[model samples]
Target: MFPWGDSDSELIEVQGPRAAIAKPKSFHAHGVHFWEIGSDKRLAGAILHHCRSGIGKLRACTGGDQLALFKIGITHDYDSRFDLYRSHGWEKMLVLFYSSDLGQVEMLAPAKHVAAIAAAFAKTSSDGALSAIARCPQNDAERAMQKALCKFDLTLDAPVTYVNVGEQCLVPCLKPTDYVRTLNERGYLHRLIGCPIDSSAGALSEFWARLSKAEPQLEVCQDLADGLVDPRTLIPVYIHGDGGRTYKHDELMIFQFQPCMGHGTMHSRPVKPNSIGVSLKGHSFTTRFLFGVLQKAIYSNDPSTFERFLEHMALDLQSLYHVGVKHERTGVVFKFCVIGVKGDLPFLAKAGNMNRTFLHIRKRPFLPHSPEDPPSFFKLDVLHLYHLGVGRDFGASSLVYLMTLYEAESIPKAIEKLNSDFKSFLLSSKKVVHFKQITKDLLGYISSKAYPVGHWNKAMDTPVVVQFAEWLVEKFGGESTPDLLIRSGCKAIGVCMRTMLSSALWLDRSEAKIVGDAALHFAQCYGKLVHYFSRKVSACTIWCQNYIFGTISH
Candidate 1:
């Protein structure tokens, strides 16, 4: 981050990441020393004036509770001008600052108050004497700084710039120190960061010692203890991308990081505060964060393009890691050790430097496909598979059977009667439905056509579906029912769907086990049921209908 030389060495050392235009520099709000480097003394093409390092104190202001602001007045041979400023005290960093004129400041309030106090002794009215005072007359020869209040200013700010990273990629990178300072000014950075401390071997050694005593089971707890004493604050950044719509329904790959304070807090907060985005347009998703924009896009066509950019970005971040940035709220120079990359499986696989292919590329049907791992390795969301999926099948078939058993002159009347009862049941249950109401089209059972399916919200409508069918069965069919096989088949299938929602977001373990057992049972039962019943039998026809109609919601 900082290049130090011998005491006799006057050569100003400058370094930058490979493919970077200028050497990395930090703007530490806290006191930080800067080496005055002339153009002839350092790397060619770098128009640098200063070199700030993780060294001694060079304060902007001596007082506490006062904001340190710097003047950006123009001067020819600025090198000589800044040298004079060194005698007074000012840190000029190589990093760019986003500055605008804040206007020429005047010390009128304090001066007026002092003058008013003096006027009191003279027996002249303090208020009248100050109130009557007008603007001072100005001449062209007067100092541009002015002896009176004027409209103009010279102040430094957080500078965002477009810099080259690779041959084809250029990204708008904010100085890491500036971003961190911005966070601290907002006064909520403590909640996001796990620990904040100054850099010292003693502090780091103390942290590792405390960490050694912590139980290995508490991952996040141990992580919190990283920056508590040590200055090297480890932050987890996640990169996730896919061709899908965002929560707002915009298409992009979103990157984010988790809050690391308190126990299990890291995992609890999954919202991404910072990111490089990927957009989905023209049937192709793009990793965009390159050149002249707040975000850079890494072309997804070549994964190595992204890999190279990261290498460059990492080199840039090393400055902040070692030199540190000042926190506005805490008034402490915090050296961050941002590491631990975590994200979705696909992103991790693509981003990681490994020989293994966790995901296979697929295009049109003509495109060749192969698996790095077996089909069994891949998992599906059990909630979608069961809760909103196969479970609906059982509901649809049971509804169809119940209506058929209603014994009206025709199937239409039977469906209408069952629909009335179902509405009453929903009212009694006081359940909210996503869809307005269950319609004949949703059921696939109108006068013109004859099919039945369950269509409703995944979770809320499930209980109603099950209870309605069971109620109708007990009310009319009972023990004398002929479509007993149909209802039995639906429940059997549901037993297989014993999949939890959040608990089993994926059928990685428990749900998979349930699914396996249920499938095996279904296969064995189907073999006997199909063999026992003739092809022409209505029992087999009804069972097939349940499987087809009920499993898929309309």
Candidate 2:
């Protein structure tokens, strides 16, 4: 991808992630060569590295919003400069944020560029022989840095901005109402406002149909998707929260708003989402942006220090639900409830502070929400529950069964041979497998608490096992040898998995019904195979069927 502007300009070819280690290449920035900026190449090189990252990390409170600190100043021997600060007793220096071009920072083109540089780079040091052209002493350089920051009136001090709680690591943000105001003022809502909203369930697309059926108190987006009522600017909203980390306990949670409406997933779309709030409880800050989407607002939340983030977030959501916020300038009434939430089970439970097993029928968490009769939210995550859980179980267990046919002296020997074939098959198909070796432990074959299921920790390697199973059946299937039922089951389930994950946007009733019946053929075959091995098969849970029928029926 090209930079934001001027694609014709000279560009640096940075190494892609596939490389073992990328060799740094010299480059220029803002019309100045980085290597030529200073005399000491070591210090100059450090600046280049830190420009991509941070130098020293500290905290600052700007307008009562706690933020990651950046000290822009001229310095020599950058290491010693930070050491003095540490000796004087400050929060332990973590990562670094330093820049020598303090006074000259204002010369940057856009005000936004100024803020972005300060967020990432902006270092300080007492002694540097040569630095950003005309480098000065520490104290004077810091004053220049502070002056530049103040001149822009950034740091979320603008009236429309909010405190940062590491909220999406936004370089700059706007308050929630201001965010809506900006969008509305810019005419992003032009087509949406006062537009005819489809409330009829039959006329609705899958997105709205499923939503309306799930709650059914009122039509799906009427509370947010309408502007027909005079003097109102309704903004339909979908709040999505996510875990910061995967394959382990999440470090923190992130919430963003993706303004969505219209018929189906593909019939229409909205601008990308932005951050509204974040939780940063003394953990080191994270700088990863979500798909490079610009975040609008930050509500600093740390469970210990900034404990009221969630409370404030709920209050803000409630305000949106109740009287709809008025645009500061336009005075348009923008009303929208969080008509829907899109997130995985873990993130949903954590954000709502509900029981981990949310589908177990418990007291409702919100004011107007009551437990569904069969939990409409049980829509199967085809990737996880199927590809990662049950499908993976069948795949690995089937592989283990194939291993037994090898008649190796030990289970380990059987496993080794099976994995060799598995790896070769996946490699031939140009798929990468993360696991070094597959073992009985990973398949949970030794466990009595549950059936022989795949309990692999890394969720990413799921596809390899899945493809391997399908390949094994394809390569070894015969009515006289391999179980014909199991072989068919593999092919059927693979087809169903691919169908469920299809990118197709719209579907007719017959097509939906066919896809709904698709998984059943394999599930039936799988059950028979399970019974053949275990002598009994547990009934498929109602929720899975409910999801299949409810969604298809929708």
Candidate 3:
């Protein structure tokens, strides 16, 4: 008997809510619209094919010529070897046909691809593959399977069909629609998981819950609040420690899981691992507390808040130092340390380490003092070093030529002159001027054809070299002093001028030698200054040896 009834009209209004809604109409508004798009023809063919053969392909005509070739269908031929297996045999495959252009058409394979069809019937009693395929496409595939079973009396001996073990009768444990509705209402289903419910929910839920609970809580120190410290202060002290602090008594025992199969033994043994012992000393609680606060501030995502927190922490440490001094004990010292990778050391040394307040602490006692030596207490963080040192240096260097031209004595004055000059230049001319307009103009002039390249290339042009040397001396004041070299603006200008002169082939051997000697003298003086500052700051603080890690063990 024909499962879709004897006549075409009866098939169109087949018994079932889906068929009732999906069925075509002849005299309705939506019917008229569907008719205009030839949905009647496609629907009729789909119904007829599905009723007779239990499988059908339906192609909608509403998406223009581009979508005319697109189709949705079911095929038993997808797994031809299914009959050879004892498990669910002759599995049906849902296929979606798509075409980029009229000439090329291809099927949208299952999410698991060919493997899903190949593994349709597992060797074990459980038909996992068939269950997986059924669960994959909740709407289309499930509806098509129901139609197939009703029309052709098809039997799928899948895991979902088994009510209990040894039962041959087909029965679903839970309807897919009911299960999906239940999961959605329970808040377990969402777009992020990409399905109504995850297959491994039973195993993963407990672990996920534990992980959430185990997550660490981060809190900021109330003592290190804003309005406590001066942002412009030369030294920012964010840590404090006493020289006599210790952490050796607090030993941690660790264990590892070992496999049973091992040489000379039937059972695995718990072996003691090699370890590096660290001793903690000096204001451990204070250092840890401040570090925690700093960490929280850094991760807060508010720069203004972070800056305020940093300033307050610095002032708090400074206050602590004063308190220690009043008690005749070791005071908290403001030793600024900036650590970074080798490439970053140069810029960091020039930026943070160049300050007159702090000194670079040497790693090895035998090693000669060098400008590249990093700060004493703090290890260099790449983010902080890049943003504060290298990044800021680039911006500062861009204004060096303009600052030199204006001959500003300080950074603030140079910035003021730059802004004013830029504004005036913009008001008078159509050309836009930036903060580093003078530097760009100087670079352009030097690179231009009118610039004397020959004079720079020759060794006899002592006048050009002398002219640059005199300019440097005048701007820096005392060319031989490290204090002069340590000034960021002077260093920037010297580096910029040296680069331009070298690039122009203007720096002869004698001129290069003079610049080189002056740079060396600056380095020597800078190293001495760093050491001197270190000694001076050590008097206020405990001056305990610090580890790069949070622990400061004596």
Candidate 4:
């Protein structure tokens, strides 16, 4: 009996969980069998077995939409790869082959045979035979395949038929005569007018002056006379597109403003109510601009620039009351709210800056810091702390320094010895194992040497801590004697770490807390060094704690 059983070919029964007991299977309906062969060799073997058993000759083979009763063969050796298939006559068979670990199906039929196959399949199905091709190549490969098929001119004698197949059918219709009138009545559409200009600093200043003269009610500031500065010259400022809108009927318009010195360009979009536009241009009297300049000065480590920036910032905020009162008189409301500020330690700690800003305000007799006030004052970037303070400065630099002390050849030899020991232990155990299991067992064995080091309170006396401190002293000499070169390396590490770890939203809060605690302990133990390594590490720990308990908690 055949594998499918000697039933009528049109009504053969399929054997599976979903098979019906009362009804016979239809001629067109068949169950698909899927096999996941482990390797190319196994796939080749399976193909050869199918051919030898005459399964390929008996079963119908499908390539794209074309079906044929064709012989299939798997090439066993490279010498007979193409020659064997070619000798068998291309029209008589389809070849099963493997290349670069992927299974490929190739047609051996000539153009005439391909054309006949395409035409016959097209007549039997609504979708053309070409559409039936499984895992069709795309782009250039698709175009090449089409070009090859076109050579055969696979035209059908019958008209092409299409089945609905649940696809939506769109019907064309004419709009009602009153559609425009109905839209007008609803007031759903508005006309927009746009004007494009060169928008250089001089042009922007002139435009602002003309606008201010035309609409004195808008109360455009006197600062507009100087024109807008290039945005690229300063740290980027981005406002959400949806923000700063107070009215639904507000028009959306963007004015391109180029800087005077040809530095870079910026855009100005007018806010609602007064049509007063603001660009990311800084002035000597604006707090926002002063703050930006302060940041640049801090980053560049310029003391003169830092002082100058602070002086300008102070002058800007001096007329704060008058500016507010003036805008109120003109029916224009000016609002300023400082959200949390993020910066590295040096920047935030500068005199009359983050630290002193809060202190001065708190000391005032009239206005005092209150618990009800929002905590949007100053924030340290947690990433800067972890990467710059802990990972780069301490962990990575220490590891690199330790590596430098050992001979290059000795390190590889040590690793080889460890690997050999691990493999020997695995072999002696005689248990079924996988990559993960071996790794777990190896790490478990190695960690035994570093275990029993109690909590942070006992960290000072911990064997690991003692050993590391001793090693540090022995490797680099007395604590008082500073290695400027190695210290510079630590600083470089801190800089890199800050850059890499600046974003912490992706990390689990608990994980961040744990790392922060570890860093704190590290700083407390080793921070007394004159090189200030501990101070940097402590900064990261503090930042982490602040982030977890403050930002995330709120």
Candidate 5:
């Protein structure tokens, strides 16, 4: 609840642990005066705002990584200039600090916690003498602003010295082998530690130059490290160590090396019952990250939750990769759903059942607030797989499913009818429900006998994908204009109708009823797709489970 830093005027009273040691009231690198707080109440409000926006983590990435990298050896005097520390590192350090425009810091760690960090920073100070100042640009427009602003007789660039935050000589190894060696380098790999540097702290570029010098053998470090500390580095930094509080303004302690390719298997040897440690249910970093994401999604309604849900779903799927129930033929009938007809039935049943379960779990009254929808590409692929199963012969199954719903004793006649209907649907079919387009498409397929093959037309045969693209344009293209939405919707409907023609290619005389049943089932599954977007339920896991079970249970 106290203000941060020191100031001569009574107007800026900071009543916190580091209140005495904070830099004097002055403009931070971004040209904002942050040295004052009207009262403790204002600071409290700032804390609350931070919690809501999750800006603490967000800024940690910016100020912690970006800024730390920028001010490697830079030292501050007037709170804005850093010449003393800069002089120590052979002019390698440069510093700049920018207050976020998004909002105030939202993290309100306990005062004791914050105090610890402030206290640590305060201890690293030299004599209370102002060092030579450094000039900075006002904005991007004028490159000469820094030189002009130095009228206070500040230097543009000066000598700097690096702070040694502990270093270990690393005789790096090669790829997979080097990976293991790197882990041994930390001795206690489980409890390793490293210093954090903010890449955007205006000192990143300079700090990067110095860190590079520390590892001359890793010439790649000299080359690639520069890329790592560039102002544009947005990669998340997960450090490890004790004393997170002391690094509040600059550093943090987090997990060390993250295993990439064969990571799960690598840890398999270390933990007993490896499934518990590395599988979906365990205490692995991903699992922990997932839980955090879920907490945010459920409690804070963060949009990022959707992304996390899919990731968790993927892990669940990976866990099920080789699992199966033994049987002589196709074996055990795992309780899953049975929808659609023939080849289409299996996929539709699985997809529908999976989506339904997700919806059931998320039983809540809420309007659609997200901009994303379930992936249509996957759905179309499933549909394509169904088509391939019926057969490739354009004379029979293929034409009916690929073109329109008409009876053609011959292939040539069916092809002509399908082409005519396609042209018509593309031009007309406006203001129709998606299902209506499917019906029209089926009719056209029955009329045509020729089935489409090859990639180009095969792509067009996917009505749902085409409709999804059109729908996306309507919802997000430019400024969601009414006219554009209507036009986009019309095109979407047309594509759906044209694509429905594919169902005909799969129908035969005896299979007519089967096809009818399949159509009904396809409709039911398609309804699930629509419902998923409105409800925001994830279907991938459900799909995987049902695929394994053979019976899709919702």
Candidate 6:
């Protein structure tokens, strides 16, 4: 008797409630909705032939396709494999090994392919010939001998009869249905052992050792079964750090993922994209907080700390949005209360009064100041940046072009008024400047094109519009800096403009059209300002060091 074979003669009680519902309709290849280069019917037939007879000559046989089928069946349960093979167009199927015995090849093939495999085995005159011969049984003793032969391939002189074995036994193979059901409920499949023995002969307890070793080797052909979408990539925006100047940055600075449906299509939407969006929102909040902290640090005489903060903020932004190319050429900058872009646009909008008040902190504003203010350039303020175009066409949102701000005493009260003003502008009044321009442009354009205005209702509900009110408050209410800070602010205006323009040009393609030309022009002019601040900062660092340490010898 096999050392670990369970007794086949023992009376075993089978107990379980019947399935509550009929078996679900099995998914087949014909059921799949797919359009591809080849015919699955022909492919399925070819696969069936190959499994039974071996791959002799198939015109388009790729090893990758062959491997895919094998891995699909062995790793995935039957139902999943069927769906996968049907969808992926696998033209060949074969087995590698069984969980019960790793050394031997297990069942392989199309349902009809087994007949050819059996015929092939009948012709082979190796030791495997006995395994084939045992398939045919003439009488009870021959059947018993065949059953005994299945236990060990070795031949013995004594005829192994069912009567001598003391009992007839049936070892049913665990069906794929059971395996899949277990996996669905438990999140994994249990190792099943199939071994036959005379039940009258012994207890099943003796087989525990062999049963323990029945675990199938699990190799994930595709690690991401739900099609490669991880929730982390969609919504990552937070940057956390100690209160010091240490900035944690991400090396993989871009958010890129292959949606199952493919890119640029709705079906290719990443699984859990909404969750990712939320996660990225949290990250944005964190980055905004840190950017504020770093700017404050700069005022505290720790400007170098802003560099670290910029690194964190840059990574946080990249995690959610496709802004890697922007950050690459344009070095991201962080300040005490607001982070600014060193490129054509400030990827981060300033929170609170940083743009309004911190005009003299650096040699230039982080964005191009309008031409109105002055000896240097226009003083960077929310009014000038948004209303007159801050970063240029590419860096600035079309919506920002619609806003203008005036000084307010208490920010929260101001925000309430701002909200009321926006509501009035949209619903009650037609006096807002930007809306007037938009309405005129839109009406004229629509009259010419003959498109109805109702189509734009969805755009009215766009997140940009819906969130604009709260966004404004968040931007200004977080920290309050007095306009006097603007007086002490150095000319960071130059550096801000330069960074934006350079980044804009670097990311633009050579064949860019008229819009591209405008963007490039913006980048070129703004980028030049960065150079001015670099020289001034270099000189100031030296002067501050010399004045404080009393040693310029180094």
1-554: candidate 6 lDDT, tens digit per residue: 00111232111111111212222232231232111112222323343443332222221233333432233233433335545675786542322111333222232223233334545576664545444443432222233444555656433222111111112321122222222233224322111111111120121222211222331111110211233222111111122222222223211111111111101112122323111111111123221222222223232354333333343333333332332111112232111111222211121222212333323333232222232432222113322232223322111121221132435565344444555655654564232333322232322223222211211222223222323423443444423222112111111222333233333211234423433454344344333322333354454434333422325311
Highest TM-score against the true fold, candidate: 2
Model 2 residue 220 distance off true place after TM-score fit, in angstroms: 5.1
- Candidate 4 residue-wise lDDT, 358-427, digit = tens: 3233222111122333232334444344433333234323332333344457644533543454355446
- In terms of lDDT, the poorest run of 10 residues in model 2 is 275-284
> What lDDT does the true structure give each of the candidates?
0.40, 0.43, 0.29, 0.30, 0.29, 0.27
TM-score of 5: 0.17
Candidate 6 ranges with C-alpha deviation above 4 Å: 1-283, 286-292, 295-424, 428-514, 517-554
What TM-score does prediction 6 earn? 0.16
Per-prediction RMSD in angstroms? Answer: 25.7, 16.5, 28.9, 26.0, 28.3, 31.5
Candidates 4 and 5 compared by TM-score, better number = 4
Tell me model 5's lDDT, rounded to 2 decimals: 0.29
Clash number for candidate 4: 6
How many Å off is the CA of 517 in candidate 6? 5.7
**lDDT per residue (tens digit) for residues 76-172 in model 2:** 3334555576566533322222234443332322323333344444355332221231232232343344455455442223133344445344232
The clash tally of candidate 6 reads 41
Candidate 4: stretches off by over 4 Å? 1-305, 314-334, 339-342, 352-379, 401-407, 410-554
| lDDT for model 2 | 0.43
Q: lDDT for model 4, please.
A: 0.30
Give one digit per residue, the lDDT tens place, for model 5 in 101-120. 22323333233333334345
Per-residue accuracy of model 1 over 1-554 as CA lDDT, tens digit each:
22233563232322321122322343333222224332332221121112122122123222322444455433323446656776686655322211122121111122333334444554644543232222221111122223322332222234675555457566665544455555566553443343333322333343334434532333333444554424234332222222334323443333333332222211122212221111211111111211121122354555565554444444444554456666665466655443233333444444454212222212111101123322322224333444455546456655765676777997668767887887887788675556555566655444423334456645546645766676677667555433454445545555664442212212346667776776555444434443444343544555554443344222
TM-score per candidate, chains pooled: 0.33, 0.48, 0.16, 0.22, 0.17, 0.16
Error of 2 at 443 (Å): 3.0
